[model samples]
Target: MNNNIVYKNVNLKEFTSCKTGGPAKYFIQIDNVDDLINTLDSAKKEGINIFVLGGGSNVLINDNGFEGLVIKIQNKKLKVVPTMDDYFEIAVGAGWNLNNLIMELTQQSISCLEDLYGIPGTVGGSIRGNCGVTNFEIKDVVSKVYNLDWLRFNDYNFEIKTYNQNECGFGYRESIFKRKANIIWETNLVGKKCNETIIKEKIKNIMDKRLKNQPYEFPNSGSTFKNVNLNEFDSNIWNSENLLVVDCEHRQQVPAGWLIDQCGLKGFSINGVKISEKHANFIVNFDNAKSLDTFNLISFIKQKVFEKFGVHLELEIQLIGF
Candidate 1:
């Protein structure tokens, strides 16, 4: 229960990847599970709302700032264990950077995460969104999730639990963690051993493809909208846009970027935010953008895409403080 971890009136823009948030009224860095529990307890006692921040890669904070406590998880611990057969279990702290973890696993000849190279955010944050690329997702290799069930916080309990893959409720960019407001502590990932040369080549290809298709040159929170599932909508309307649809593990999905691109909204801007010319799915903070600018652009994109194709686009990035 260390009490020296709090800070007041901290600028949140410095903590997010988009770099456009206002100051947090109260901020705290949690280094361990015990400290996080203590901090949450204190905030609860004060009736202050709580926001847990991870790598800050997939969230947009509002310009007005959060009124309550902002907890930044910083517990970084990594472990690797070789079990029977060709299986290797990797345990990563929730606060561990996801790209770093992938690199470390790839260097060790682990094949499970080689295709996910260059994805941003912390392991915990990635799991919250079930982050992935193409056909692979964090849920594929995640065997177990260690977390503090926040629902029990009111009962004076801080006991942590380990949930198996099924209990995690993993679906297209979703998990029970998002619904339960649970605090992810760490995750157990299992991967098969592969030739280091093959793993490196695959990683290289994935990284190159990402660089080519994504707008990484500007400050952005990655994809702004989720891909539309084909089964959910009238398939005949998408017949002409077949080139824009890609096969995902879940189903045939229409890329949100393609929808925005088809609406002629690429490079569209309002204030300082612009839908990236390089990738329509990204709304870049190219000119010192405000959260409101991004929000308005999002609404505009949704309206235009709907008007053009009669399909509504849902946001993938999480909004904070708004």
Candidate 2:
């Protein structure tokens, strides 16, 4: 049998969208189910820490590199199987590009992913992160999740299963995957069929709105903070009579953009990282902007916002290494 494991130091910057990260001790690509099992088993045997890297879009890695192995999910395919009564179950590999998958699904009349067009990263990343705007996360439609337990891919002994959103423990940008750190091999998305042209048009509208607001050209995580809740967050905001009625009605989910912009942080900068002059929520790398640059910018925003508004900003981007 051909050996699929790679033992080398991988420059994570090349794989990450931010264009800056240190290096990984070991990098492995799992192209199929068999490959995934093999890679995981080898890592376990060697007593190496495992980090599954999916499109590398919504994270900033430290400049010092990861101490464990980085497994890049390279298996890409979307299989459409016909179900009863004009329905279809789409099996999407975790390695698939999220945008491309959405676009293709829209073209083929898939209804669920239309509003999720502009989100970056991969199928598994989105699933694991539970990414979405407000209440429209990807886990909303997940039917059954397939997982490989203990890196055993060859046989069914190491397999595990979870069904639906409740089992997934999906919350605001969180799931069991964050704690368990297991593999999401594929997803069975059961969605209704719609007119292909209409689906495409809707996706285009939502996607265009996203592009117009966010800076797509620059390398940065989409949003820096998860909005704090009104009831569960810091208790100080409750007695304030000046809180926006809209914010109050929504309970805790305030838009990070509004809060950041309100703090006059749109053009804020530190070193080469600046809160994208276009969007307050985005912190971009201006040429020589390294991981440290973004880190400092985030720090400035957090500090300033807390001092000015008394609300701490919880980051949405996954910060690794440092």
Candidate 3:
């Protein structure tokens, strides 16, 4: 038991956007990398699996709970450095709130990520998932990522390393962090000097669109499924309706919400969990929903979409403890 690390029981439901999950047997909040490494060494000796938790968005934890240690990141340092003529580099701690960072930068007349306004979660989680909205992704502005190599625990040794944007392996909702299990410590992003008014308007427009289309009033993860790639679908069927194409770095994409809506699944419910009326891709916790409720609902949605459209809907949210 490292004195610098505090461990206790905590309900995972309180730490997630869905607001429905069981307790974590052991939990600790980390403020610095040294303490995290020390605590990891201690936990390794105890033979407990470590689960890192972020801002509690874009995840669905199981009802049975995590039996190991849950590490909540809390570091929140931010720094801006001038790089070139009009572009600047900003370094942010992994635990900083995504929306707050965007707002802070925009207020300073630095606007590069205004398209991602109102998205929830922490910098670490966002980087891990490569979170994005229509036509914009976090990877576009990322300059570098700082992370601790934790997989080499045999020597009880660890080293902090900086990864360039290309080395991060960023794709649509994909990154090296997902595969390497490196502990993200900080991120450096590029931003350009812009008019404050233009940034504000962009934020306003994006937020308004989200409010109008998403189920923000209910407890839910942002999007349940990843958008389908057009190449995966039959051209004749998908093109019949003129499928909306998203310009991604890899390939053309279609909206999962559109597929669900076409299946007439809006407002569908299984117990307390329901497909959001405003957005078919979102499953809302309208009446004290359980983890199983969402799980069963997602299975049902996948089955129906597959049957109707001959397309598989891949999940976007990370499933914890299930």
Candidate 4:
């Protein structure tokens, strides 16, 4: 192991946005792909399980902690190349903060990512979950993604593989990275040039909407569940339930928050965790809360919503230790 980069029994609560979770038995932060390979090689030799953490915004960690090596990607390399047309490409590290990247793009008058202004977490995590709002998603701007097949570390094969946009297999709140053990190292995003004033206005409007709709005062992991596709339900069911249907990336969808609200789960609490009154989709840690408390509340919500609407709610946040 690279002793200089590795630490033992690091508290993971300090890393997560929710301010929960126990300590990581082993932890390392990698700033480059080469170092990540070397670290994975060492961990492989030790027979330790591997977990890659980015900005720690979209994860729930168990109180028992992770009994493995947690690798935090911190490579922040960035380069922008202008094309012949009114377009540009940005090559950024996986560890780059999503909000910071959007702000940088705004300063450069890039129009593609302005609508995604207020989202949290790293570029890698956003791509893994295909994070976005309304009609915009990380997949739309992604041109290419570079990652390492760490699951093959036992063979000492650490070659970097590049995937084109379609090969990413992006869907609603999902991507190939979510299914495969490959670790994203960097990505290339294509954007179009736009007026700086227009980009700023769009960002301001999106930020204002997020501040008004989301529960930001308490510690929480953004959205708890993924929205259901409208086609999954019968037309009569929608009319009978009086569910609100909205357009998402040209597809009709039902927001999970609205369903939770319909079930009367908003502002519900158990232990120190509570469903946010401001946003039914957010489960916030208003006080000191255990991971189990949040887990139980999530289970209860799924059951209630299922009983009422017969729709299964899928989690958006990654559960680590549990």
Candidate 5:
């Protein structure tokens, strides 16, 4: 471990939303670019595998502890700058919590992402996943992303480069960052403005719906898959008139939750790991759940869904550890 980095023999359960996983050989809570670069160098020198962890909202880890270094980002800061009428951009640190950031922004009458109501993880994680709700996604608002030049570590210490929306290949829950691994330091968000009272009311409506529909009592990541064509119409869901409704869309978008529910996966459990009863899309911790249990249940869902529907469900979460 690097003298500059801190942490050792730490359990990953506490950090992850699923509350699963074993201990990590080395761990560091990073707050800035320097710390990230230093830790990357140290990991390379030690010849250990590296896993960059955010809030652990959208991922599952192996029960066996990692034999490598894990870096958890925590640097969160925001700078609000005005650009145009009812338009503003925010330079945000990677570590900022997703919901809290939205809440703060909504309070300021900025409301581009009000519909993306409930999501887990950090801003960087959301960017990595291109998280969205309904038809809106983070990719639409991302003006630029700042990250290290290389995948692991850069001996040349590559300077941060910025890319506009065109360079990032973004689709439902997937982005260029999803395919690439690097330390993301900041992102510039372009948002819309509204009346303060109206924005707050909209946010309240969204939150109220969330509290009524989604379970907030226990920890769990949001939905599990991007819609696919193969698994569409399992229960006559898209049986409307001619148009696709995500429409003109020849491709079908399948919802994994509906399938899981059909497969009797709701409230399914493997030890302490349990699929959320309220929302089949969520996986919850039922007291000291181990990583393996979570892994097993997820596997079980996939197997059954595949057997019945002949389509595979892709994961929305990133897996880090063992």
Candidate 6:
């Protein structure tokens, strides 16, 4: 890799949504698969560990920063082809900003992505995390995913693999990408052609709902923890705690935010970081907080919630370098 492409000691705070973190020891941005392959090969020769970053919305970088190479995906290629009557196949680059992609698709009368409006992050990051709201998940529209095998790259072997929707191993806030060393390059999504007016209305409704419920005015990663399955807890425990259960696609779930609020942690602060009073699930960087501050507060919240409810909250945000 050349100096023109690879940068040293690049600050990561500017890239992440939380606006807190140290720096990447080595950083490079790639807009094409060829560049990614070449970069991986170069990193392998240098014996450097690799971390792929997309829009940086759902991640927390440690205060000490990452010592390895951070590859930022910036590819934004998008193509839409009509596959059948009122049905279209959309091939999108992994790095495409998800919100922007949804808007563009809505302009073309695409329907499947309307509910995802106002969600931040890139296409690949959203798929890797299986990001969703209420009853709609990105997996519902994903037809196929194309990725590079990161594990093989370390062996100086460049291999590309494609996985159909079922093979992606998608679950709540997770996918095979989270468990395996797969670098998502592109994805194929299936959408139906709908009336543009109806699509826009759906987007507006979802956006309104998010604004009313989520604390969007502050700088924060979307959701701090994944909602727990209600079945995981005894029915008597739910009644004793007065835990509210909502039906999510036939399964009952208890919102993480509710648990945090029940523990009286909403608006709680440690240094400049504080849990959002508007939504307990969001820990916002209100006054130039340090990454360590957020980390400690998350630990505190977890301890308190577990002591009170006996439910351990799992982080929805990805922790990088920690």
The number of the candidate with the highest TM-score is 6
Lowest lDDT 10-residue stretch of candidate 6: 151-160
Error of 6 at 262 (Å): 0.8
Instruction: Give lDDT tens digits, candidate 4, residues 187-264.
Output: 999989988898888788888888899988888999999899887776677789988889988878899999999999
lDDT of 1 by residue, 168-214 (tens): 99888899999977889898999898888898888788788888988
Error of 6 at 211 (Å): 1.4
Residue 101, model 5: lDDT of: 85
Kindly indicate the candidate among 1 and 2 with the higher TM-score: 1
> Tell me, what's the RMSD of every candidate?
2.1, 3.1, 2.2, 2.0, 3.6, 1.9
Instruction: For residues 7-87, write the lDDT of model 6, one tens digit per residue.
Output: 999999999999999999999989877788788888888889898899899999998889999998887889999998889
Candidate topping lDDT? 6
Query: Model 1, residue 294: what's the lDDT?
Result: 93
Q: How far is 108's C-alpha from truth in model 5 (Å)?
A: 2.8
lDDT of 3 by residue, 1-322 (tens): 3334566767889989989888889988887878888888888888888888898889899998889889888878889887899889998999988889888998889987778888879999999999987678899999899987676754445777899999999888999899976789898999999999999988899999999999999999989999999888886777676677776665788889889988899999999999999999999999999999999999999999898778899999888887
Q: How accurate locally is residue 127 in candidate 5, as Cα lDDT from 0 to 100? A: 82
Model 1, which residues run further than 4 Å from truth?
1-4, 239-243
TM-score for each candidate, following the candidate numbering: 0.94, 0.89, 0.94, 0.95, 0.88, 0.96
Candidate 5 lDDT, 1-322, residue by residue in tens: 3334668888887888777778888888888777677777767777878887887888777778778887887878788898987789888888888778888887788876666666667888888788876657888788988876446456675566686777767776767776766667788999888776887787688788877766678767667555556435445433431223242134355566767877888988888768888878777787777766767777898899778676678777766653
Residue-level lDDT of model 2, residues 1-322, one tens digit each, is 1225686788999888878888999887877877777667767777888888898988999988898988888768688887887678888888888888877877777677766788878988888888877547787777767665454433436664554656788777888877776788788887778888888788778878878888888887778887766554355654652443233223456566667787888877877778887788888877767898888888888887777567788888899988
Q: Candidate 1 at 111: error in angstroms?
A: 2.9
Clashes per candidate (backbone, < 3 Å): 0, 2, 0, 0, 1, 0
Model 1 misses residue 142 by how many Å?
0.5
| Alpha-carbon deviation at 298 in model 1, angstroms | 0.3
